[model samples]
Target: MDPLAALRRPDDPACDVYLTGTVFLDIIFTGLDAAPVRGTESWARGMGSSPGGVANMAAALARLGLRTSLAAAFGDDMYGDYCRDSLERGEGIDLSMSHTVPGWHSPVTVSMAYEGERTMVSHGHVAPPRDPALEGDRECPPRARACVASLVPGEPQEWVATAAGRGSLVFAGVGWDDSGRWDLAALPELGHCEAFLPNAAEAMRYTRTECPLRAARALAERVPLAVVTLGADGAYVADGRTGETARVPAIAVEALDTTGAGDVFTAGFLTGTLAGWPLEDRLAFAGLTAALSVQEFGGSLSAPGWPEVGAWYEGVRQYTLSPEAAAAAGQDPEALRRYAFLDALLPRCGRPGPLRRAVPTIGFRRA
Candidate 1:
């Protein structure tokens, strides 16, 4: 009857899933601008830190009420310390597989967004071809009802391969541009993944695809299930079983940072799958989960918990915008809310005015 007994399979009482990937300290900055005022610095705003990438995804999945086992690596430093402690203290994550790399500085990222869009500038002191290993009492995979891989760069894909090899159902979605450009080499990585969900940009950037559906197809060839996130345009899922792709409509809601919406979607899908929901229901749940995410800043914080998501799903109009409001705002009202949230949570370029000056704060910074 012990929860740990169900760590690998659904019937097991504790039914927990394990997440293995690279964990980093996300030092996110909201408003970043270095517009040259002929030697005078412009007014700047500051935003602090939050978890990112696989770590953020793990925390999100845990918040969905699953007892998750995390197998991730971070450099032995303050960043690493913070990452480890924070995840360990989460409601449902198990830290048996998390580890620390000696002496290396943990990874960090900074983002500055305007309007409804954003530009991410990152820093990676960690190099490529990394095989992150988890030690101690982590000898076995948590008997999970499902498994997910973040496939972020520096995280060896084989770790997920090992998870798949162990009779676990696998879901994969690459993280950031750091996972490297998609190519024939990435094909091998995709072979073992079950659900390959990447945004249209990531699909086009890594996997060769001229269109969103084509991206889904290319991903389908490697993995049976594929979903391509299309912002407000909604998403398309490859349905090999139905002989065509399924268009999952976007759930209407206010958006903020879209930063980790894809990760939030993946969590929703995995959670739904484990709960025995049908594929259509799974996508809708995921769609709404992501739709609500952009209404706030950061990843896990942006992702609404099940109760909040349920409220939005139940026609909670508090966050939904109106057509008249969208027209009045000259942009989607939700998008406007999202921009304001970004302004408060991230740094900004400057206030808007008739006599204008807008400088992108992110592209100038180095990753």
Candidate 2:
């Protein structure tokens, strides 16, 4: 079954996926030798600003040639204008459903990178007032093949159910809960979602288990599909309805920045799911996409395009697979069967075009 077939019908819908969450104007400072001292300020070699949060995933999906729509609150300010223009013009994302509030300020995140790690400071107010167009009886329902959203603790998201009501597959992801409250009260909402993705830490915290695999299994029992991402170690996935499970190792890469890696993985996995690939293949593709993102700086700007995906697939398939090694590689005797789906989807060349200066990023200011 061609999951992407629905996307090709021009009369069907303009967006392949509708994503909703907090959108931040990110100012990423890279190349810091150490954290700033309490008395004195430190210096960074480079800095960049772009849309973050769910925007990261939307950008990733758009970069992969997917028609994506974003629904969120935006302030009528310079930062909001930059984010909206960048996502719409640069990344090809649709924002017609998104709202812009007057007199409200967009969120700003200042991320300092030092030795592959980062310290972020964000400032923002509570959600801005909703647009009158989206109020009462005029609420707009998203039209797409699927919908992606970040889970909010304590209640079922109205958007998730709205999309599902329209026959859109719903994918939900969770964030770090510093409150130490797992808030399993939202588990019932997972029943309305096709998948629930969370990092190992969040999964373990919510499940009260030390093992990520155990957390994944436990989550699967509640949702149709459960995927737990383990940094460096890889990912564990379980399909409750099908009783299928798989664990894929992380693709080795020198990570420059870990920002938005999880978002990129969601984009990649969503792409593979839409293509109707198997569980193992979806996990590997997600891993590869995330590995590529970390090699570059910035959040949404770091997402890999189809070219990167194609190149990685070609490089992996180049390794010679002997009968002995193939047997040890798991079900795929050739060990290359997982990537066969890319044979048709990948373009002839995945090489990127000349870099264009869309944002005036600061680099190497005289100290």
Query: Model 2, residue 170: displacement in angstroms?
Result: 1.0
For each candidate in the order shown, give its overall lDDT on alpha carbons. Answer: 0.62, 0.79
TM-score of each: 0.71, 0.86
Lowest summed-lDDT stretch of 10 residues in model 1? 354-363
Could you tell me the lDDT of residue 123 within candidate 2?
Answer: 98
What tens digits encode model 2's per-residue C-alpha lDDT throughout 1-367?
1237544754776678888777898888777899878999888877677788778899888887678988788888988988887788777788877888888899988888887789999999867656575655633556777888788676567767788888888888986765668967755567678989999989988999999999999988888889999998889899999989999877667776778999999988898887788899899888888999987777798898877777777666644345555445432434455567677767443434732222435222457
- Model 2: per-residue Cα lDDT at residue 91: 77
Off by over 4 Å in 1: 1-15, 31-48, 101-104, 127-137, 140-143, 151-156, 175-185, 204-209, 242-244, 314-367
lDDT of 2 at 224: 84
Across 204-270, the per-residue lDDT of candidate 1 in tens digits comes to 7766668888878776766778888887787888855455666766756554466777788888778
